[model samples]
Target: MRILVSNDDGIFAEGILALIRAVADLGEIVVVAPDQQGSASSHGISLHRRLVPKPVDLQIQNVEAWSFSGTPVDCVKFGVTQFGEQHPFDLMLSGINEGRNLATDVLYSGTIAAAGEAALQGIPALAVSLDGPPFPFDEAAQVVRKMVDRLQFKTLDADTFLSVNIPAESVDGPWVVTRIGAEGYRDRFIRHTDDDGQAYYRYVGDVVRNIEDDDSDITVVNKGCISITPLRYRFTNEPAMDTLKTWF
Candidate 1:
């Protein structure tokens, strides 16, 4: 299997590095990741600016790597359009992100977006993430390695991707295929101005879990189980179309 890896946490992030190391031996691995952090960037692409992907010889788990000065999605797009055409890839992998991506968080996750872009291009993709502070990446990598090994890459459907979130607690071994939980933080953002009269705002407060719903990611994580949600690009309102038509 040929695997292309990328991440929103930049090329040198511990999460990406760990993931690359873990999955390097699984197949022919190539990395095209942001030169700097691009978290919460969503599926944003650098449209106005010419993307400059520079190849860097970084020793990641003894594997050679490259870096990019664009969003995570850009990395995947660049890899497919440039390199994959010649060599081809069986799969595309993103992250082992520093934090969990659950519920609506997927809309703002560059890690997930990277995989989404690949799926859009008809590649089997996986976006892996972990909860809380950076943990033992080597250990995490081992877990991911097993999952990658068992994956049936050729059987994946078009425009389909998996959003896998690992719990902070060790899973003892592999993670279960679970659904996205409805529970998540009541996100809050605060606006403020600096003394120099510059307008700036900072996000404040800690995330609160709405784990009352058993099927939500928060509940799953709280139970020490991994969540794997199948995702796609379509955002239809078929159920609400008639209701919305009434309003019109």
Candidate 2:
């Protein structure tokens, strides 16, 4: 299988290298990733600026890599539109990310956004992340390898992709299919004055978990299980349509 790999954590991050090592035996691997960190960039694309993708002299066995001066979504877009024409990819994998992207965190994750972009282009995609302060990328990569192997034979919808979150403690737990959870960081900003008396604000927040919901991705990961949540690009709220139609 031909595979394309990309990440939001930049091209030199250990997470992306671990991902490459984990799936090296799968097929031909081509990587297009951001040149710098893009953690909370979401699905943002660099529309008004010149996107420069430069070839990187990476020594990973049997892999070609490039670094892009754009968002993670731009990497996938370039991969699909340019490199894909020469060698169509069977799958697109994004990140063994430094931190877990679960619940509402997916809304701000460039890692998940890369996979989502691939799904939009009709390619099978998966975004893998791990919970970490001390990122155990090697262990997470092993789990990702097994998951990728299993996914090789499975058929997924063209419009959907998988967002996987692995617990940092262990990879021995069962894999669970889950829904997006309500857990998110409560918004908080600290106002500060600069030396010149200029006011500035810094964003900060605590992760709030919805413990009552067991079927959510956050809960499953917290319980030491791998959480695989299938996601689609559609944002339409179908249930609210009828309520608005009554007014019309």
TM-score of each: 0.89, 0.96
Backbone collision count in every prediction? 3, 0
* Candidate 2 pairs with clashing backbones: none
Per-residue accuracy of model 2 over 1-248 as CA lDDT, tens digit each? 88999999999999999999898888789999999999999999998999998999778777889999999999999988888987789999999899999888899999999999999998999999988766889888998889888988999988999999988886768999999998778889999999999999999978876664788897888898999999998999999999999989
Output the number of the lDDT-best candidate: 2
lDDT of each: 0.81, 0.91
Error (Å) of candidate 1 at residue 85 is 1.3
lDDT (Cα, 0-100) at 56 in candidate 1: 78
Worst 10 residues of 2 by lDDT: 205-214
Best by TM-score: 2
